[model samples]
Target: MMSKNPNLTLTGPDLAALLCSRVCHDVISPVGAINNGLELLDEGGADSDAMDLIRTSALNASVRLKFARLAFGASGSVGASIDTGEAERAAKDFAVAEKKTEVIWNGPRAIVAKNRVKLLLNLFLVAYSSIPRGGTLELTLENPEFDAKFKIVARGKLMRVPAKFVEITSGQVEEAIDAHSIQPYYTVLLAEECGMELGHSATGEEIIFTAESVSV
Candidate 1:
């Protein structure tokens, strides 16, 4: 069922809930691994190999938690500012699971807005969909203004933007699907919320999405 309070904007509590949900979802697996490893350690015949597994799982879980906080948590909580190297590290760390997509970062370290952080994560999801076989994802931030511009380029074999996804991005459609399509929807939502324009297109195995800040 849909929410009755349709006009309700996302409140601080709402955002907090969303962030908590995201954190829980991401940490579940590694937490489970750590638990299993601890159980193994408790076993009477535990060996060095078991201890190594425990250590590795704990480290992996720690990294995941730190990265998730940086990506999804509040900007101030992350740090005073995030450098390009830090951004690149965060992107690569977040993009590790899929293995098919390589995230490349460009541009100087600017204080990334919280909304942009969320948009970038969604953009990564969209890029993953474009390159089913695997490819390189390039993200560039430029022209920071009331309506700043962020460019995302996904290039690889068989990179084709789905027409329906394009329609949603262009404000021609309004329906939600899973993450595969939801990313584009949220892209449009974020643009509209920020008084920005979202442009998307595909050309010769390259799909590009750009968000331009709109003039008041």
Candidate 2:
């Protein structure tokens, strides 16, 4: 565990760079596998296995890239609404990446403000990462219109919650926003921007995240 920095504030470019680095970290494995598969094909081995490897790696890379886009990218126009169905699809695809996590998204297909949806997806990132050994994520929504609120229930074996997670997410620690700690801070930022407040709690086997709209 790294020591907390109370004065942590990241410049726009620095934050962008770290986020790009995180996305690269995710896609690198599958992209590297694809390259390896291609190199094997070039070495005069035209086995079905090589082709299968390439196909699978390509799909994995694609799925991860899509997830990153919605999770971190500027998804749509300013003040535009994103289809809840799209967010659900992204979450489901991301969970299936390891075949170890199951996602039960009860969020309907209502259109939501882009920032709200981004907040939801980013919360998913934080929740999913807490369960290192993989688990189940159930997303339930409330008042999906203007006063949108949601809860994420994460369950798994041996769940790990850093004491600093809540601190960072609530903007308590401002001095440390590295690759490892950026997502939670980012989630907090989004919530604040969207007039929402976040809460988190954990037990031995379950972690719950709740975000509710508040008067700003």
Candidate 3:
């Protein structure tokens, strides 16, 4: 008989590349639309409403670009330390228009590992999914050395973890069921690869996921 717990494994670099690709793929269209709108603005006669739309689209594209830098690029990778302020701002920028979720950061500033950066992006995506009607998300990073933990708490009107997400995070599922499904599963896999355990808990109005280092 097969063991109940089979090994879940993935390389950090590999996952980061995949995530970067995914983010780029998703943002390219909106960015292109922004470019197209700008071109239209340059060619079209001046109209207040049309100009407003162009400005709005340009702003949206800019925000998305900044978010992509943090989520997929090296916004957090500078010198030997990651700027917590920059990372927090980048995260907040992404959710600025998202009334459902607010990102709150609480932790000391330190250089986070590349893998940690990737994990944080994935966590942000997961938290985004939990808040469909506006909510607050609190994130705390503890310990930055060999042993580290990231705690994410999402509070909102409907902050319950779906069954499929739980299964994916716990290694109970293996296939991606939908576009919004893979992040959590891959997050858990990344945690496991880094010798960490991803723990999850949910209450009536809150849901929490903690990724902590585990001794091998």
lDDT of 3 at 177: 40
lDDT of 3 by residue, 1-216 (tens): 332224334355656666666666666766676666677677774566556656666666677777666655655435334555667777787777433467888888776666666667667767767767778889998885558888889888866676656776655765644334545656665565456777778888788978888775
Q: Which candidate is the best by lDDT?
A: 2
Our model 2 lands, by Cα RMSD against the true structure, at 3.9
TM-score of each: 0.66, 0.89, 0.75
Write out the backbone clash pairs for model 3: 100-134, 100-135
Q: Candidate 1, residues 1-216: lDDT per residue as tens digits?
A: 332223223455655565566567767787787777778778854767677767766766776676665555565743244444455576676566435678887766655556665565556556657777888989887854235677889999977776655776544554434323433555555556556676778888688977777666
| Model 3 alpha-carbon drift over 4 Å, by segment | 1-21, 32-46, 73-81, 97-100, 162-164, 174-179
Worst 10 residues of 3 by lDDT: 1-10
Question: How much lDDT does each candidate structure score?
Answer: 0.63, 0.82, 0.67
Clashes of 2: 2
Top candidate on TM-score is 2
Clashing pairs in 2: 8-174, 8-175
Judge candidate 2 at residue 35 and give its lDDT.
93
Candidate number with the higher TM-score (2 or 3): 2
